[model samples]
Target chain A: MSLPLLEVDDLHVTFNTASGPVHAVDGVSFTMESGDSLGVVGESGSGKSVTARALLRLFAITDDVRIAGSVRFDGVDLLRIDERKLRDVRGGQIGMIFQDPLTSLNPLMAVGEQIAESLRLHRGMGRSEAAAEAVELLGRVGIADPERRATELPNSFSGGMRQRVMISLAIACRPRLLIADEPTTALDVTVQAEILLLLDELRRSEQMALMLITHDFGVVAATCEDVQVMYAGRLVEKASMVHLFDRANHPYTEGLLRLVPRFEDAHTGRLHPIAGQPPITGGGGSSCAFAPRCSHAFDRCRSEVPPEVAVGPQHLSACWLAAERAKDATEAGRPWKRDP
Target chain B: MSAAAARAVLEVSDAVVEFDTDGGRITAVDGVSLQLSTGETLGLVGESGCGKSTLARAILQLVPMQQGSVRLEDTDLGSLSPRELRRMRHRIQMVFQDPRGSLDPRMSVTALIGEPLRVHGIGDRASRAREVAEAMELVGLPALVADRLPSELSGGQQQRVGIARAIVTDPAVLVCDEPVSALDVSIQAQIINVLDELRDTLNLAMLFIAHDLSVVRHLSDRVAVMYLGQFVETGTASEVFTEPRHPYTQGLITSVPRADTESAARLQTARRLVLGELPSLLDPPSGCRYRTRCPYATDRCADVEPPPDLLDGHHAVRCHHHRAITAGEHQPSSKSMRG
Candidate 1:
């Protein structure tokens, strides 16, 4: 079989601060085939965004921060590559969009020129041709008047419009993979729908792989085909979209699924909020990180780290409960009913 | 009707607030009338520029309404002198979206919660200290948090401090503007629960403003949908959310992404694509502000605006095509209705 488009193995990112070493991303590993869409769902400080950034090596290089892992893209290890080669790979092979477009874009530069700069740098397109292509991209992203908007500064554009501009800039090179970090969080629900639709369209038409990092599962359900649930800087569960939703194995994943309020559950009375906040990452130990907040946490969970084991075909969960279930099934020589 | 009128603690009539922008006069809240009875929660839902926040500010009397009469317990705030309004401010309080931004970073938690009591000059040093500690405990904060700065607390803790400050004076009406939007999902539930419990036990009138339809539905006894500076629909939460009449309100109901598997499945099966974004408030459409993005726009919709129609004595909708639309006439495009 052909190798996967991108494979991240034992990826770890740590920040050394006055408090201690903050292990922002603690040993995350996943693989994405060509044209596949993977979602990383978690709350803030869950290390989803940090993991995505590590794929592109976007964090500032410094003595305070330690990054150790293997990120193989197109048969080449991105982590081992030089900075110059990585820069070439970033805009050409992988493009990223952020939650806030205004902060990402330069206020002084015209919207069109900002996007055109990428085309010139990556594809070496001439000035006029790049400018024309930028306008075309703006129009493709559903802008009402692309020709005029291309000349406007970032300040003149609305939030949704600015987001569209950011999308255009990202897709200017038509990269193989796109990392969208809460791309629609700042927009209205209606506007968010439109943006998601655009991203879906781009994914299909370009056969582009996507790493969608977001807190909202609804957004992920709409966009991603494969799902990975992260908590306390670790990937607790990874499975196909259908399996992950129906058979949520990890207690943390299950807690998040039930915690978020739904429109239909308007009068359902009392949301099941996960008690207490997520623990601070980077604590040295073999103990389970989520034991404090998990309802299914046991004595073993508090002292020993659970290895990710196959709960179902192609579905993996890192929880002692899953291990217990597997042990019971093997001992009984038949499948056993899981507790509710 | 008589009972509601008798129990009404806050009444706003023909409220109009205009801003003098470079683009000329923009009416943020226009001719909106509403009544808030004692211990009732009124949820105001709208998109970003629909003027929900402006209406909240107008009711708080923070900004001068160009023309309107705001009566709090039969006292017209417009007629009150500056000093008189200041004296009356203690009974009315607000909780803002950003807990940290709304609170003073320099002040300790105790000082922040006690400032309202001090300004009203209700208690002496010893009594105020007792009251401050009580308020902190009331909102589920520990006594030790009183000495910490605003920055030292988490988002949820900061919001509790905010709620404590608002209720310390025992305000008759409390206006919360997107109180939980900045918080995480679990924390959001905690804050929402606190607000709901406080409203019920304290018998306080509340105007809960939020863009999230789900949260508003949970908290509000009555709900109002605003579009381009006007109240398009208002009714009991169940009636308004379940049987939304206004097209704008319907779009909001069907657009929200839900978490429950049943609704998510239903949404996936019957998901409708919602149309365009809200137009700029600077140049609103003639007659019907929503018509620009509305799918059922007709000649009448553009020519003359339909006046508000009251149904079942409580439910109100402002749309000429609401009846036909509700009857499934001129079926909405697959684009806007999800579930």
Candidate 2:
């Protein structure tokens, strides 16, 4: 059988700061198959973006930061590859787009030239041919009047337009995977919906895997098929989108799902915000990181780290409750249910 | 109607704010009018460049209006002298979006929260310190963190400090301009809860301006939808959000991704998305400012500005075809609606 498109095993990313070592991503592991669309959902300091950057090894080589893990893309470990080969894998095989497009894109170069350069470098296309294809790429991404818009600088484009340009640039080489980090957070909801539609369309047409990192659950509900929730630099829950919405195994996930006020929800009274704050990372203990904030956390959760337990067919949750439920087969459904 | 009108602590009429740019004169805030009653929250929601913030500034007379009147209780701020305006500052306060950016980094939390009280010269040295500690506790901050700098606090803590500063002088009207947008989801909930509780306790007339529809729907009693510097629709939160009349308002409501499983399943099929981004405020559309991106735009929508069509003196929509659109009589231009 063919290997999964991407497999991340025991990924740990730490930074040695003035205070101590900050464990941004701790023991996170997941697998994605070809053309799979996964959403990495988390809040600030939750290590969602750090995990993505770690996959690309995008951090500058430094003594302060420590990265240890195996990231297998199509059965090959990206960490073992040399810089020359890693460069080919970065833009040619896997493409990345960040939150701010203006910073990611060149301010002085023409928008089309930016895309063309990527195409010429990665695909070895002629300059003139790449330029012609760049216009086509812009049109594919929902940019109107691609020909004229292509010659304009990044500063000339609006936020939404600049994001479209960034997408076109990333997809110029027809990369097998695309990692978009908060791609539409800065745009209006209407523009955000359009960009989401464009990304969904491109994923279908190109059959490319997508790893969309965002903090908004609604955005993930709109696009991703599978959702992975991160908290305190650890993966708390992983499940299909429908199952995650229906039966969130982890308390942290349940808290997030309940707290986020849905515009569609009928007036549900006051929001039940999760009490306490996320703990500081890099304590390096064998305890649950989310125990401090988790409402259902117990003494065991505070003392011992919970292992990934199978809660459903393809669902896994790293909570002691999940392990308890497995031990007692008679106890069905989630241990805790949200108030009606 | 009379009871509500009597309770109105802040009234704005025909508020017009303009800025001169290199391109031309841009009407950032067009002729907009709103009334915020005591203990009532009015959510001002719009995309970027819709001039929601500018309108907030106009209400406080922070920016000079081209031609308008801002009346706080019995006083008209337009006729107030510079000294008089300064004196009136304590009555109405504003909390900004970027908590870290708005707070003075050099000052301690206690000092930051106490600055407004100090500026207004309300209390003596000893009394000011006591009041500062009280405000800090009111926003759920501990007394020990009072000595810490703004940089030491988390985003949520920083925002709490900002809210504390705004309410320290016991302002009657609190204008929060996207106060929780920069925070994380969990912390955003905390800050939102704090704001809601404070509004109830203080009986403050709050204009909670934010682009987040969910948060606005949660905190607001009344909601106003702005497009290209004009109020396209205004009504009770339920009326505006559940039964949106204006096409622009409808688009904004439908654009928010439905989180429920049943509705999310229908997301791909149901397409009432807005056509394009907000048009340039420099040269806004002649008639209905939203006509450029509105799907139900007709010849009348382009030729003449649609006057406000009030429904029972509560809900108002500014669209020529709102009636037809509401009754499902008009068809959106299929070509532009999809893209």
Candidate 3:
């Protein structure tokens, strides 16, 4: 079989705080094939962004951080790569689009110069060639009057337009994989839709693997084909997009889905909010992290971590209740009932 | 109707706000009018730079208006003296979007919620504490959180405190400006539920403003869609969202990612009506503000402004091509209606 574009196995990331060591990412594993889209979804502080950063080794992991995992891309181990090689792989092979375009783009430089710099460094193109490619990239991403916009500073562009510039910069070298972390959070709904469509078109045209990190499931439902649900630094569920929406095995996923407002819902009613906050991790050798807020928690769930249970052809969930529910539904010849 | 029964909690008529910037004169709000009946919820939705927040600030008399009038139960807001306006402030309150920025950093939650009651001279120290506790409970915040600072609480908890402060004075009207936009999806649900419960118990007439069409669709009794500085469409939430008449309104609704089975295909087919960047408020386009991006734009669209066409008793849209657009006569090749 062909090798996956990216594969992360048993990844663990920890942070040292005054109180103790915070286990940010614990035993998260997933793989993305070429041209496949995977969504990493969770609330803030759930380690979704941390996991994305870990792929590129962006975080400052001093003596405080204890990273124990293997991240392999294109049959090469990323975690063990040297600094010079890692630098080459970071922007050349893998590109990342951050949450805020205003902060990501340099205020002092012209938008075209920045994209040209990326092209020159990664692709080793000459200055004049890079300038032409920069404008072409800008136009490719649907920026109007790209030649003029390329020379303009980022401050002149709106948030949506700046985001388009960021995308142009990210894809300047034509990386094999692109990681987008809440790229549209700062945009309005209409602009957000346009950006999403643009990303979808680019992904299809380039056949590049995409790892979209977002808290908004609506975004994932719109673009992603595969999804991984994270909770309190652990991967709770992994499934195909269709299966996850049709039968969300994890309780946290169900709660999240219910929380999203639907058009058909009554205008005024009590929303069913998940009670209690996510637990704070003090160390790395703990049990299941979501035990505190999970309604399906049992004695074992509190003391011992549950193993990944297969739910469908490629779907897996780390919950005792999910396995039982799946079996019950299968035996009864009925689909799993969703909680309203 | 009896005098007591007929009093509107807040009424705004022909309200217009303009700003003089370096570029030119900008009409942020133009002839926009609305009324807040007691114990009613009105949701205002639009894309960014649509002047929804400007209209909210105008009602609170925070933003100076060039023309129009605001009345709180027959008291002319524009005519009120400075002292009279200060006295009238107790009857109406506002909750801002950023809870962390809105609340005082140095103050504890107790002090923040208690400030309004103290300013209004509603009760003594002991009674004030009791009232604070009651307000906390009303917003579903635990009493123990009263001692915490805004930074110590989570986003959802901080917003509850914001609501508690707004409702502490028993104001007849509450203007929530995107109260839950900064929160998590689950936390947004909690805050929305708290607002719903508070409205029913306290009989609050709320002016809810948000950019998310889905959230507004699930929260508002009547929804108004704004474009540039004008109201493009206004109707009951169900009518406006389900059967939008204005091209801008229909475009906004179709843009939201729905959970229907056909959403994927419909998303591909829906035409993006609004294009380019929002026009600079300092020099808005003449005639129809949306004419710059409208697909069905004609020569007349740039010369004559389209008046609000009454689609139904409660529905209205301001668009010259509303009939052709809504009737599917000039429908785009890819338009599909998803749930």
Better of 1 and 3 by DockQ: 3
* Order of the predicted models by lDDT, top scorer first: 2, 1, 3
Poorly placed runs, candidate 1 (over 4 Å)? A61-63, A323-340, B1-6, B260-274, B332-339
Candidate 3 segments whose C-alpha is farther than 4 A from its true place: A60-63, A264-268, A282-286, A328-340, B1-7, B331-339
Per-residue lDDT of model 3, residues A206-307, tens digit only: 998888999877788778889998888888899888778777788888777777676645454556678777767722445667778777788887888877
User: Fnat for model 2?
Assistant: 0.57
Interface RMSD, in order shown: 3.2, 2.1, 1.9
Can you tell me the CAPRI class of model 1? acceptable
DockQ of each two-chain model: 0.43, 0.60, 0.60
Expressed as tens digits, the lDDT of each residue in A74-100 for candidate 1 is: 889999999999999887889889999
Which pairs clash in the backbone of model 3? none
| Candidate 1 colliding pairs | B273-B335, B273-B336, B274-B335
Better of 2 and 3 by lDDT: 2
In the predicted model 2, the residue pairs found to clash are: none
Q: Write candidate 3's Cα lDDT for B162-206 as tens digits.
A: 999999988999999999899987789999888888888998888
Error of 1 at A137 (Å): 0.6
